[model samples]
Structure formats: C-alpha cells, structure tokens
Target: MDNSETHNQRIATMTFTSVYPLYLKKVEKKGRTKEELDQVIAWLTNFDEQKLQELIEENATFEKFFQQASLNPNAHLITGVICGYRVEDIENPLTQQVRYLDKLVDELAKGRKMEKILRGT
Candidate 1:
C-alpha cells in the first residue's frame, strides 16, 4: 500500500481515550476548563459527556469513536492547520475529523472565546 493508506491505518488504530487527557490538560494548563474543551468536542462529534465518558471507559479506537459520531453540519467550517497539514485539505475524512478536534482545542488553549471557537454555531 501507499503512504496515504498507511497514514489512515495508523490514525484509525489510535485510541480516543489515549488522546483525551492530553487535550484536557492542554486546555486546563491554559486556564481553560474541561467544560470548555468538552463543549468544542461536542460541537464537532455530537457526543455528550455521558457518551464521551462511555467511549473512554470502553477504550474505543479512533475509528470506532468516529464511526459512532454524528458529525456537526458545520464541521467543515473548522479550517486550519493541524499537525503541519491544513485540516480542510485532508483527503481522508477520518484524519480531517481528528484534526478538526485538534484545531478546536488549540483555539481554546489560545484563549479564543467559546462562540468563536465553535465558529459561531
């Protein structure tokens, strides 16, 4: 297989529970609360606190986590660079979804207000 398939496979196997705390801590360290972080996540994935917690407890992989997600209609509006690639330019849907969350968290940690971070949705 080529590099794109390999990239997608690597991301698909990653556990959502593993990256969650890092997202939380990154926000908290910037004086942003967990609630704020969760809010942005909910906006993107449509996973409420209970569902998010359940996924974590179940040790869901990124693939399963996204498969169950109801992506926000405006999720496409979340455009920017994450992990050196522009989120909007990512050809793989799964990678784009993951980067969408990352970009939102990065915005929150940078002190952008909720409405702005949520892209006014």
Candidate 2:
C-alpha cells in the first residue's frame, strides 16, 4: 500500500481503548484511597488524547506513565509501570480487551464514514 493508505490503515486499525479498562482495573485493585483515585480520574478526565498519541509514538517512558498517575493524593504508595501492555490478571485474560477494541473500531469507522458523507468527501 502507498504511504497515505498505510498510515490511514494504521490509524483505523490501531487499538488502545481496549487496554484502558485493564489499566483502570489495575489502578482500582491497589486499594488506593478515595482521594488518590479521584486524582487519577481527574488526570484521566483532563488527559489529551493527541498528546497521549504522541507519547505512544515516541515510546512513552514508564516513569512518565507513573508520573501521570502520581498527580493524585496517596500517590506515594503507587510506584511501578501501569498495566495493559500485558495484563497482570490472568484469571480474566484479555478476551474482553479485544472485544472492546473491536467495538470501538467499528464505531469510529462508522463515524468517519458519516462525516465524510456529510462533507461530500
């Protein structure tokens, strides 16, 4: 495929949200205080998707990931790489992760097609 086609295909096929819940589960399992959880949630709320995409492209440091989580109270107890690259909870595996990502890809493709048709692209 040509470069543009390959690039678009990558964007269309890449999956990240599948692991988001896995990350959340790991965060929740640490028994963090409510304040700490809130802080992490706040960071998530304000998180910039584009910046995160850039970080992913640049090979985001494990330190950077932890720093993002550290903004919350009780962060002192949390030190280590986040989950999702590889799931720690083997009992539940990643079957759900793949399903969630597939759903997201479908929704996104539908939205993109809808937008293009609206704009007559």
Candidate 3:
C-alpha cells in the first residue's frame, strides 16, 4: 500500500477519546478552560457538549467522529500551520479536519479571544 493510504488508515482508526484528554491537557496547561475548548470544537464539528460526551463514552474512532459531524461552512476560513502541515493545503480531507481542530486549540491556548478562535462565528 502507498504511504498516503497507510497514513489515512492509521488516523482513521485512532479513538477520539484517546486524543481528547491530550487536547484538554494542552489547553488547560495554557490556562484555557474546557468550556472554551468545547465551544471551539462545537463551532468546528457541530457537536454540542452532550453529543461530544456521547462520542467520548462510545470511544468513537476519528473516522466515525468526523463522519458523524456537521462541519461548519466557515471552517474553510480556518487556515494555518498545525504540526508543520498547512490546514488548507492538506490533500486528505480527514487530516485537514483534524488539523483544523488542532489549529483552533492552538489559537485558544495562545489566548486568542473566543470570537476570533471561533473564526468570528
């Protein structure tokens, strides 16, 4: 199999619950709150607090989590480098979505205002 396919498969199989705590830790260490993280996540994925919790309890895979998401139309407005990858330039849609979340969290951790972090939503 090719490298791209392998990468996608690996990411797709990752559990959202496993990665969520790390995201929480990253933001919390920077003095950001869970509510702010959830707000940004909701803006990006349309998953409210209850729904997010449900997915977490279910241990949804990254692929399943995204598949069930109603991505915001303005998500395209989020553009930046995350983990050395440009969010808008990613060829893999799933990877781009993941990076979009990362970028939002990064902004929040950097103490950006909620309005700006939500991309003026």
Candidate 4:
C-alpha cells in the first residue's frame, strides 16, 4: 500500500482520549473555554457532553470515535490546510474527517468566531 494509506491507518488507531487533552490545552491556552471547544466538537461530530465523556472514558480510537459519530451534514463545508494537506481534498474518508476536526480546532485556537468555524451551519 501507499505511504498515505499506511499513515492514515496509524492515525485511525490513535485514541481520542489520548489526543483530547492536547486539544483542550490548545484552546484554553488561547483563552478559549472548554465549553467553546466542546461546541466546536459537537458541531462536527454531534456528540453531546455525556457521549463525548463516555468516548474519552472508553479510550476510543479515532476510527471508533467517528464510527459512532453522527457527522454534521455541513461537514463538507470545512476546507483549508491541516498538517500540510488540504482537508477537503483528502481521498480517504476517515483521514478527511480527522483532518476536518484538526482544522476546526486550529480555527478555534486561532480565535475564529463560532459562526464561521461552524461554516455558517
């Protein structure tokens, strides 16, 4: 398989709980609140606080986390670069979805307004 496919597989295996703290720290350091971070995540994944907590407690991997997600219909509206890749142009659906979240978190830490961050959804 190609290197990208291999890379994607590795990313998919990463646990959400493991990465969630980093996301939280990033936004908080930027003077954003946990509520705001959660809001951004909810906009993308449709996971309520309870469900999100459960996922974290379960140490769910990105693959499993997304499998249980009810992805927002407007997810396709997310665009731009993340980790040197254009998120909207990613061919792998899982990879694209993960990058979508990454892009959103980046925007939040960058102090983007929620309306635009949610892509006016």
Candidate 4 lDDT tens digits, 1-41:
23377889988999999999999999999999999999999
| TM-score of each candidate structure, all chains considered together | 0.95, 0.24, 0.94, 0.96
Clashes of each: 0, 0, 0, 0
Q: What is the Å distance of residue 87 in model 3 from its true position?
A: 0.8
Report the lDDT tens digits of candidate 3 across residue range 4-111. Answer: 888878888999999999999999999999998999999999998999999999999999999999999999999988777777888888877877888998999999
Q: Candidate 3, 106: how far from true, in Å?
A: 0.9
Poorest 10 consecutive residues by lDDT, candidate 3: 1-10
Candidate 1 on 2-120: residue-level lDDT in tens? 22888898989999999999999999999999998888989999999999999999999999999999999999899877877888988888888888888999999999989988889
Kindly report which residue stretches of model 4 are placed more than 4 angstroms away from their true locations once superposed: 1-3
lDDT of each: 0.90, 0.35, 0.89, 0.92
- Of 1 and 4, which scores higher on lDDT? 4
Q: Lowest-scoring 10 consecutive residues by lDDT in candidate 2?
A: 85-94
Q: Could you tell me how far off, in angstroms, the CA of residue 101 lies in candidate 3 after the best superposition?
A: 0.7
How do the candidates rank by lDDT, highest first?
4, 1, 3, 2
Pairs with backbone N, CA or C atoms under 3 Å apart (clashes), candidate 2: none
User: Per-residue CA lDDT of candidate 2, range 23-112, in tens?
Assistant: 445445654333333333334223355655554565544334334432323222222222332222212212222322233233233333
